[model samples]
Target: MYDLIIIGAGASGLISAIVASSSGEKVLLIEKMSQAGRKLRITGKGRCNLTNTLPLKEFLKHCGSEPRFLYPAFNLFFSKELINFFEQLGLKTVEERGGRIFPQSGKAQDVFLALINEIEDSSCQVLKDTQVTSLMIENNRIVGVKAQSRTKGNKEYLAKKVILAAGGESYPLTGSQGDGIRLAKAAGHNIIPTLPSLVGLKLKDYNQERIHPSIVGFGVRNVKATISLESGKKIAEEFGELTFRENGVEGPIIITLSRQIARLLSQGERLFLNIDFKTALSEQELDEKLLSELNIRGKEDLRSVLRAFLPHELIYLAIYQTALDPRKKASFVTSQERKEILAFLKHCQFEIIGDFGYEQAIVTQGGVDLKEINPKTLESKLIKGLHFAGEVMDLDADTGGFNLQIAFSTGYLAAQNAEKED
Candidate 1:
């Protein structure tokens, strides 16, 4: 009988097995995928942003769904400890803009290699392509887990402790697919309904010609985006860069605010996205700048003159929205035309029709409810010896390595506490 059986070989499960087995406990790590960490191998656009360097208070602000529940986990092991853990495994890291950390080698495979190598060196046994279907419980305490494998058929592993790190519902191809939540539900845990978070949001009245595939990847930098109700009530706001997708908008800001947007949209609320391009400059300042550009380049075509203010692609959108003739000389442009152009540039609005589904989402917003689990120990309060970790819990965070840190810290804490005698 193993001392601990860890479900899923993703970020949290791997760390759980490593930490548990390193302390001379017999550990079994299971993965439904052909190889472990398939999702991890592709995170950060294939570069793998490991964790953030923000201080604890600032970092927790980025997390959602009971951020205080993670106090114990982060206190145990945070970004600094996580970095040191990887470096000790011979994986050097570097911090980039916005305090995001990545492997110095710029290879996510290297990060996976570091974890898998540590597992191979430890006493833990790993099983790939094995799906744990249920927790084997007796009198509401975890006794073991029942799993099925294509080659090995149905199997049962006996262990007093089981760490469920089966991940969230996002990226089904990576083998998450809400399996962990299913197991938790079957074990009598109340699950918060799951929603796609950090995904692209679709826009109403989408113009194929304007946001065509040609400009789908076009990004706007240093802008402020606001989401508001049809009643003009502000919902959420973000500042950074956002990229135009074929359906609507995406990127750093969009993904960070996607959870709130997705939740509101799911409730059948009318939402709109407002982009303020000239946030750094007031309306009067922007108008003065536009006047100077038009007067100085009076001989230039209005289209050519607009190039000084916006990207060539955005100029087309500006012209389409303002109904201004591109061929007109800048000097001949009327005051009304200039005002329309300025308005479109300052407050470009789009109705948010819906958001992308789980397939395109970076994380799942809900999972096992936090109240049912012990915040300090990460064990299920309803079931002794059953611990929870990673995205399987109702914990999720914004972009910039916060989510991955949650996985590592919670996994380590769950395993470290699970190995103790009852």
Candidate 2:
């Protein structure tokens, strides 16, 4: 028998085991995958944006699905505590744009190594290639768990406490395939329906030419993208670079916006994305400049003249949308055609139909409902000795390291509280 059994050796489980073991508690960490921290090793494109340096108040603003539920966790162990924890483990960190913190070596493996190293050097026992099938509860009190291992076969382990850190169903290859939610459900906890968050959104009736090899990877910087309802009521707007993918739009801004867009689309809301390529110029200013450019380049072909106004990859799109003859001389261009070009540039709109789904999403938005768990202890209010941490709980945030910090804070909080359990 152990003092605690933490399932899923990802970010939360690793931290939980490290903390619980540090307090002299006998802990057993179970990981279904062959290796731990699979997703952590690939986060931030292998750089691992570990946490944000935002103050408490500012940081809370970026979280969703009951951000206040995390107040207790953050109060106990926020970004400062998290950073210090890693630094104490000999991993140097640096802050970057938007207050994102990354390992000084700019390697996600370093971050994973820091957490795993602490666990390995401690008394925490890990069971990889073992899948926890169910929570063993008697009279609404947690006893232990039932698991099956490829090498060890079926096994039952009793613990004084259990921290369900099994992640959400985002990257299935990383072993985060809704195992926590399933276990929580078996233990009589309510689960919030899960959906893909921070994924690229698909456009309705998008032109096939837009995703051509020449344009799929093109990126436009300093553009403003807005999401609005069919009634023109604005929902959200973000300003940054936008990337065109084979299926739809993506990038830092688009993925951040997808957190809300995914839910809105699922609700059958009609949404549109209006991208302003010339955010710095007013309509009249752009029109005046267009007239001047067209007049001065009268001898040039319309196709060649358009190169001055838009990226080469987008020239075909502009001409296709405006229905203008590419070979026409700039001098022969009509006022109507010029207006069309201006409209396309000023307000390029795309109807949001769907998202790229969980397979490509960075995080899962919903999980075991927060109401069923004690915010202070991360323990289930209904089941004693049963706790939750990380994406397995109903907590998600925008990019820039907010989500990872949630995992760390809640993991630390859960372990600290479990250490006090009898």
- State each model's C-alpha RMSD to the native: 1.9, 1.3
Candidate 1 residue-wise lDDT, 58-129, digit = tens? 999989858899999999999999999999999999999999999999999999999999999998999998
For each candidate, give its TM-score against the true structure.
0.95, 0.97
| lDDT by candidate, in order shown | 0.91, 0.91
Model 1, residue 310: distance off in Å is 1.1
Report the lDDT of model 2 for residue 233: 94
Q: Which residue segments of model 1 deviate by more than 4 Å?
A: 210-212, 292-301, 328-334
Clashing pairs in 1: none
What would the TM-score be for candidate 2 when compared with the true structure? 0.97
